[model samples]
Target: MAEVTTSPRTWSPAAAPPHAPHSGGPRWRVVVGSYGFRLTLVVLLALAAAVGILTYGNPAAPGSSGFWVIVRSRFASVGTILVVAFCQGVATVVFHTVTNNRILTPSILGFDALYRVIQTALVFLFGAGTLAATDGLGKIALQSLLMVGFASLLYGWLFTGTKANLHLLLLVGVVLGMGFGSLSTFMQRLLTPSEFDILSARLFGNISASDASYLPWGALVCVVVGTVLWRRRHVLDVVALGRETATSLGVRHQREVLLTLVLVAVLISVSTSMVGPMTFFGFVVAMLTYQVVGDSRHTRTLPMVAAVACATLLGAYFVLRHVFYAAGLVSVIIELAGGLVFLVHLLRKGLR
Candidate 1:
């Protein structure tokens, strides 16, 4: 037995064992260790796919000048792929963030329909020959600017009005898409078969159809805009908490939404102008990004989303172009697969 004079030991809070388990133990480790490994793997896969596109299926000797020429030509396509993926991934993810809905994509805004209208109008009013005439940097610039301006005007007006709400904004966008699509259909009906044929090819979201000249401008714009978006990631995370919560948390919800929408317009416009119109491509990439990264944090997801997009598009390009000998069918396959996935997701959760 202990001596009577011995002081009894007390287990105070300060005296608690340091090695005891914690519910929040090393969370950063989980975040960093798991996400870092996955991100690194994805990035490596994307690099491999890009390299395969550059090196595979060349007829010339590996070190020959002719081999480099083929690689350079393929480089143009790969560059286009990067720009498109970067734009779509970033835009769709940001769009999801501001809207507080992962199910929605930027395509709902009638960007594709507007692009089709612009294309159909070119062939309808100016004739098929004018399509070729409009292939310069100027045409692409004008298209992007017009689309951005339209979106800015629409967003600025709707969000500032007394009745401002996402539902009304969405309703207007849907109505506009329908109207534009109708206008395009009516015009397409008037074109001769040959003119329609020429118009048809331009309307599909064909990465190969991108002009090499557009790559630099696209890349420049992507860098500038991407930086701006990245800087706002924290605000976006707040924004994702819904309008009421964001506003309660001192985040100007409407202002942020308007600004985010404008930026998204710039990205979608650039991508649409470059590769015609990609209705479901962004949706697919964004979906894959969410699945692979398994987190909603914008800081982690933004860059990761772009990397995932690059891998997906590059892999599709490599497979179809090399194995199937059907490079032109990339858009078709993506749309089909994306549509099915979209349906399954929609049905599984129903619309939020």
Candidate 2:
């Protein structure tokens, strides 16, 4: 009787197998079934439309050298738009994730205002000629470093304590941003008309103003920081669980928050340096991403946010440039639309 052992159990084809780790399906199919696949597809379609409108019907024959030249020229603007979209999209999403705030963007940390202050100060102190003499890439590097350093120091001081309060941090940031803005305004008022005009161009976020030379550096920073964030997606999920929960789960909550905020600062610096200040674009993109993806996980939401941002930027550029022939107005229109969306969101939600 003791030797009468049970036979090993076997799974039948009709019965589900024992639980095993998911290896994920085919790449294309997985992407197709993703939460924001339709939004991504729409963005791709809009990008194609934008490229077509920009490159088609050149005075040069379709296959001629001149045609290719025109296409290359058009691509510069498109490239800038895409870069700006990626930077803003990823930065804002990560920012909201780390801060656990839906209404706040990386820009709210005062990077944009700092950028404006930098520009205004440059013009006010050294004159427009000196400002114009500064190289584009050099300016980007300097501004990015300044912003990153400021954010690192701020986060280090404010969050690396046992009694850290995010609300206090945000409130302080808002006050600093307002102070910077007021100083910038005061400086601008004292400038000559010519100097103010030049500074004004630099203050407004404009895709056309992006220097092609800065693209390589901007793309490099974005790719490196983005890859780091992707690698830490699981960690981000844990962090989003709130500081106390994350700590109980063995996450270094303060350290992770500091690191995340530093990266956010870097991304915002690159975007602002490349294309000037975009106050509400990131807010709109992140909000739309949350709505479209319906997921809190960074892995699911980040790409969708990027796609929505790209679509918004490219579609707006195409309509403004080709349809209305007001390419210069693209940033203004975006800010206006984003502001309206922000207002609506606030009105609907009523501060939770």
Candidate 1 TM-score over all chains jointly: 0.90
Candidate 1: where is the Cα deviation over 4 Å?
1-33
- Could you tell me which residue pairs clash in candidate 1? none
In model 1, the Cα lDDT at residue 3 comes to 67
Tell me the spans in candidate 2 whose CA falls farther than 4 Å from its real position. Answer: 1-36
Residue 20 lDDT, candidate 1, scale 0-100:
56
Count clashing pairs, candidate 2.
Answer: 0
lDDT of the structure predicted as candidate 2: 0.85
lDDT of 1 by residue, 1-352 (tens): 9767868897888887675556356765686568788889889999999999999989999989999999998888999999999999899999988877878888898898999999999999899999998798899999999999999888988888667888788788989999999999999999999999999999987876667999999999999999998899999999999988999999998999999999999999999999877777778888888887788999899989999999999999899999998888888888898889888989989765
Instruction: Give per-model TM-scores.
Output: 0.90, 0.88
Error of 1 at 33 (Å): 6.3
